[model samples]
Target: MSLMTTLMLAGGLLLLNGAAAPAETRVDLALVLAVDASFSMEPDEQDLQRHGFAEAFQSPEVHRAIRQGMLGRIAVIYVEWAGAFDQEIIVPWTVIEQPADGPAFAERLLRNPVHRMGYTSISGVIDFGIQQLRHSGLQADRQVIDISGDGANNTGRTVTLARDEALAHDVTINGLPIMLKRPSSLWDIEDLDLYFRDCVIGGPGAFLVPVREKAQFVEAIKAKIIREITDRSNPRSLIQPAHDALPTNCLAGELRRHQPTAR
Candidate 1:
């Protein structure tokens, strides 16, 4: 080959190789805010849920937590899900390093329109979260799936299966069980927090914060995000240890949704 042609071919190969190897962003944590938008979550409750997450990102404590991380940065994605096949990415992976980035992230979350879909599928969201974490073009020291929902896994495969799979992949699962209203629906189960602790959350530092009232949304979300970001596993957050007997039926939602009179 001519010298000029050889140099051009070499440059072409270099460009092709570089194109095939995409750069990945490194951060302290990769957090998937997997929210629920099931039909059971009333419109007002959905509003509170969105506001809570938005305000949590805008909080001083959360900002401080992110800043204090070893890398001083974290990657986050917001997702909403319902049913086994219903999942939407409200916000793609974004890095938050400075104080301003927090609000910017919050703004992105708040700007999106809220959604309410049929059925609740905790397992679906968990599996979706795992996919996002693995494919997210970001390298992180930790990965977490934050689940906030009012109902249980009615339309998906077993919740524990998904939880265990994520744990096996070194991903922690956290919970914010919204219990503002009484468990009046067939899909709603009493002791939702216990359900989350025993069946949903697991990993090295897994914990859950139950939201029992409307007033606690913002603060509860803020505290949970801080704990996840700081990697502080407070046993107090869990109602009981993981090895203990399941406090509530892990399949209660599935059962209730299928057989309304089983309870």
Candidate 2:
């Protein structure tokens, strides 16, 4: 069967055979995990990040969050960002409604090979995310772009320019700022949180969560997922597909939409 057909079957199966999720959900939130693959982040930091997301998807909190959403599921995609044009979609939209669905997705995410494209272009990821969200088939009240990175946007149209454009369309964008030990070289960035707060993150009720240490990555991911899944301030933001990435799918591919323009 086609992937889309499989997804329909999966959603139907989950609703009939799987545990219950919410109904009439307005938001079809898709987390565009905009990660930083810049040269500054060390190998250990990268592993911590990758594993953190994997672990979060497996957590009970995430499961609870999905169950709490009006639609009880969410579609998600992952991207690694560095240069203005260096963004690569590492994961495609997969819905997770049942408890088992979340863990399965997480496992797949854990196994997906790394993409090494490097640049620090937060705006590039946002632009790419806009395209993904626009092309994703589900319709809802809110569109979210969860951008996580360790540096300011030194590339692409100025970060604020891109962010403002997204906000204008009523899209909510959250931020995850990674603050590891400063690098001894140019790749290392300081004041990352401030930079993200001032230039990178924005949207209705947009917020930035700081990853204070490498060890805290997993916890941070869990917290973010909980907030994304459970919060109803933007009832339209609740996703109904279910889980974020666990085991990444190679079948995930970009759709045919004009990319989000960098304003």
Q: Pick the candidate with the highest TM-score.
A: 1
Where is model 1 more than 4 Å wrong at Cα? 1-22, 238-247, 260-263
Instruction: TM-score each candidate.
Output: 0.87, 0.76
- Tens digits of per-residue lDDT, candidate 2, 5-62, equal 4664333211221332233323445566777787657777877888888888888888
lDDT tens string, model 1, 1-263? 77853553332211111122233777899899999898888888888889988998898889899989999988888889998988887766677877887898788788999987898889999998988887676688999999999887887799999999999999999899888988886777888888887789899888888888899888888888999999976756455435645456888888887784743
User: Number of backbone collisions per candidate, in order?
Assistant: 0, 26
Residue pairs with backbone overlap in model 1: none
- The whole-model C-alpha lDDT of candidate 2 against the native structure comes to 0.65
List runs of model 2 lying over 4 Å from the truth.
1-28, 187-189, 232-263
lDDT of each: 0.82, 0.65
lDDT of 1: 0.82
